[model samples]
Target: MSFNEIKQHSKARFKCESNELASIREYVRLKGLSLGLSEEEAFKVSLAVDEACSNLVKHAKKRSLSENGFYICLKIYSDQNQFIVEILDKSQPFNPNSVPSPDMQEYFKQFKRGGLGIHIMRSLIDDIAYFPAKIDKDYNVLQLKKLIA
Candidate 1:
């Protein structure tokens, strides 16, 4: 399919795992490039999306009840010069903005190994948002967007 075709596309649901993240990244990169993104911009979008997917894998594993794994939906828009990646998982709801800003001084003292995912994602993407799923309401929704040239 062509780039314009993809821009008009939207998938309602899909499942993914940590191992499958690479393929998803590649797919987003190609779609971004086709929509006029520079290689560097495409890479940034891919990496941001990968981080979101990885978060789902790390946090949602225990909550998954069936073989479906985690659900993801991607929407690409050329006219908008942007791509939206939405991930849904049965993990506890987390507000990215609510995460304590990283403190380098406390990092070593408190011995917290992780909590940088949101920081990295925010830096890479044009926008990020979190929302509680409306129905089948156990899941949390993470939305990310990156702008292309």
Candidate 2:
């Protein structure tokens, strides 16, 4: 079925586990395609989601020795021209502006090896916005927006 057939919001909670990162990538890619995104666009969207989830898995510590207590949610919503993916993480309140974006020219010149997940994720999508958790809200949200072409 086409994405418009559903029209309702699409959302999923990706288990913050290393092994599940692949699943998250596939889910996002297929969903993007179903939403009529071009193949290249779908791949880019998936890559961005994968990078975000990979970072989450890399830093996720087992809370309370139980695996069932953790999940980073991915909520998808769309407008006429935009598909938005919002990732909700419970770890810390983050301000995306606080981190300096690396210069691609300088980074390539230096042959940087790691620590570019955020940069990559930012590049793949059309827009990104961060909303830190409020007193009532326990989880901070990272929103990735891909414009449907």
Candidate 3:
């Protein structure tokens, strides 16, 4: 669906600190379950969001709404078939293409600690899209979609 259409649907915005991650995860989890997702499916949704927020807390250097805080806007859209989640943040813009798909065998051999969030998001969600923040806009937008099975 178009971004405008998605934004017009059910949505919520969160401005919180790193410690507030659990609350955001719970919100997504409950929304997923309430929307009829199986527990496992809802957990996946929660985990994906958790990973995204964690990345921001770890890497983003932007000034928060309050000291040591960050802002995230979540927009949820539904139809007869699927659910779409859009997460917007003021984190640094990322070039998804610049990060190559990790080699699982090599990753295990090196025991890497980073670069796994994107992989997990891709694996659990049906589709993932990243939009860099434009010069005119101060936020990066990441969209995750999961199709009902």
Candidate 4:
């Protein structure tokens, strides 16, 4: 089902920070459990969501106290026995697929420190897509999903 189908179940606009990571992780875990996911599946989804949020914090702009910190929006829905999580971040526009595969041999190369985020994100989720926000002020959207079974 689309996000609108369960929009009411979604929680939007969470603070983004190294310290706030745990809360986001727990949030994902709790949401997954509500969808009938086992502990293991929920933990996996939590870790994946954490990794995605970490990437946003590391690469996105830092917010002052006067401004809202990075935004982490989550939507929960089940596809048959599988659970899907959508995370939207107010960071720079990034397309995970657009990044090239990392080269192990060149990993130590200081200038080649790219694509690792995309790689980790890709490994954790079953499906991912990037969509530009229409508001022209919101961050690029990154959608992630996983199967519970």
Candidate 5:
């Protein structure tokens, strides 16, 4: 089916494990393409989504997540002119923004081991917003938005 024939909203549930990363990226890429994103755009969004999910899975391995499901919800808001990808889990109260971006020159010079997830996500996604679980809601959300090109 072509992009114009696709629906505006969809979702998928993934386990909070590194094993699910490839599937997550594939889903995002396919859905992004069907939602009017170019192959390159879809890949970028997929990469960003992978980074986001990877960070969550890594952190989830460290702490206890009360929620069993990690969800990826996709929405195309034509009026708003955006493609939104939301990663929801009952994550602990931690802000992704707190991770400072590494200085590239220094990072390459010293050969940094790891710490580029947030940087990668931010670079590919137009906006990243974190919404903590509220009184009514039961899960923390990492919302990633990309302009519909």
Candidate 6:
């Protein structure tokens, strides 16, 4: 089936804030367990969700968007064999693909300041897809999916 045809099993929205990270992680972890994911698997998904939200907060601040004005919506859907988690943010439009893969040698050698969130997100999830803001729309959606074990 196509991406658009999947039925949403559950969803939740939270403000983009450092304080909300724990809540967001718990939200994803509970949903993951409900979907029959093992604790390890659920933790992996939760970490990915956490990283995404953290990155959004940083992005919003960089763009000068008010902390209270930024928000994230998370949708959990199943396609018979896997669970898909979609994270929507209305901060600033960015091309996730434009981020070059960091050279680990340099990143570690030079003591990088901040360039690992995307890497962690990619490593924890089975599949990651990003949607840029539409011509008239104000939000961008980042999708993370993990296959049922």
28-138 per-residue lDDT for model 4 (tens digits): 899888877889878878887887788877766643222453667776667554677777765556666687767767787656655576777677778887785556646
Compute the lDDT for candidate 1: 0.70
For candidate 5, the 10 contiguous residues with the lowest summed lDDT are 71-80
| Per-residue lDDT of model 5, residues 23-96, tens digit only | 98898888788777889988999999888878777776555456554443434432235677878777664667
Better of 3 and 6 by TM-score: 6
Global Cα lDDT for candidate 3: 0.74
- The model with the greatest lDDT is 6
Q: Give the candidate number with the greatest TM-score.
A: 6
| Predicted candidate 3 versus true structure: per-residue lDDT over 29-108, tens digit per residue | 88777776778988998898887777777766563333433678887776546667778877667644356779999999
Of 1 and 6, the candidate ranking higher by TM-score: 6
Clashes per candidate (backbone, < 3 Å): 0, 0, 0, 0, 0, 0
Tell me which of candidates 4 and 5 scores higher on lDDT.
5
Error of 1 at 5 (Å): 15
Whichever of 3 and 4 has more TM-score, that candidate is 3
- For model 4, the stretches where C-alpha displacement exceeds 4 angstroms are 1-8, 62-69, 105-115, 135-137
Better of 5 and 6 by lDDT: 6
Candidate 5 or 2, higher lDDT: 2
Task: For each candidate in the order shown, give its overall lDDT on alpha carbons.
Answer: 0.70, 0.76, 0.74, 0.71, 0.75, 0.83
Candidate 6 regions exceeding 4 Å error are 64-68
Q: Please identify model 3 stretches exceeding 4 Å from their true place.
A: 1-9, 62-69
What digit string (tens of lDDT, one per residue) describes model 1 on residues 1-149? 44435445444344656777888788878877877778998898888877777777776667565555466665555556566666666555666767766877888899888877777788888878788755557566677767655
TM-score of each: 0.74, 0.82, 0.82, 0.76, 0.84, 0.89
> TM-score rank, highest first?
6, 5, 3, 2, 4, 1
Q: Where's the lowest-lDDT run of ten residues in candidate 6?
A: 60-69
lDDT of 2 by residue, 1-149 (tens): 44445253688887788888888888788888887788999899989888877776766553212354368888777766767677887765655546788988999999988779888888898987888877888777787889899
For model 1, the run of ten residues with the poorest summed lDDT = 3-12
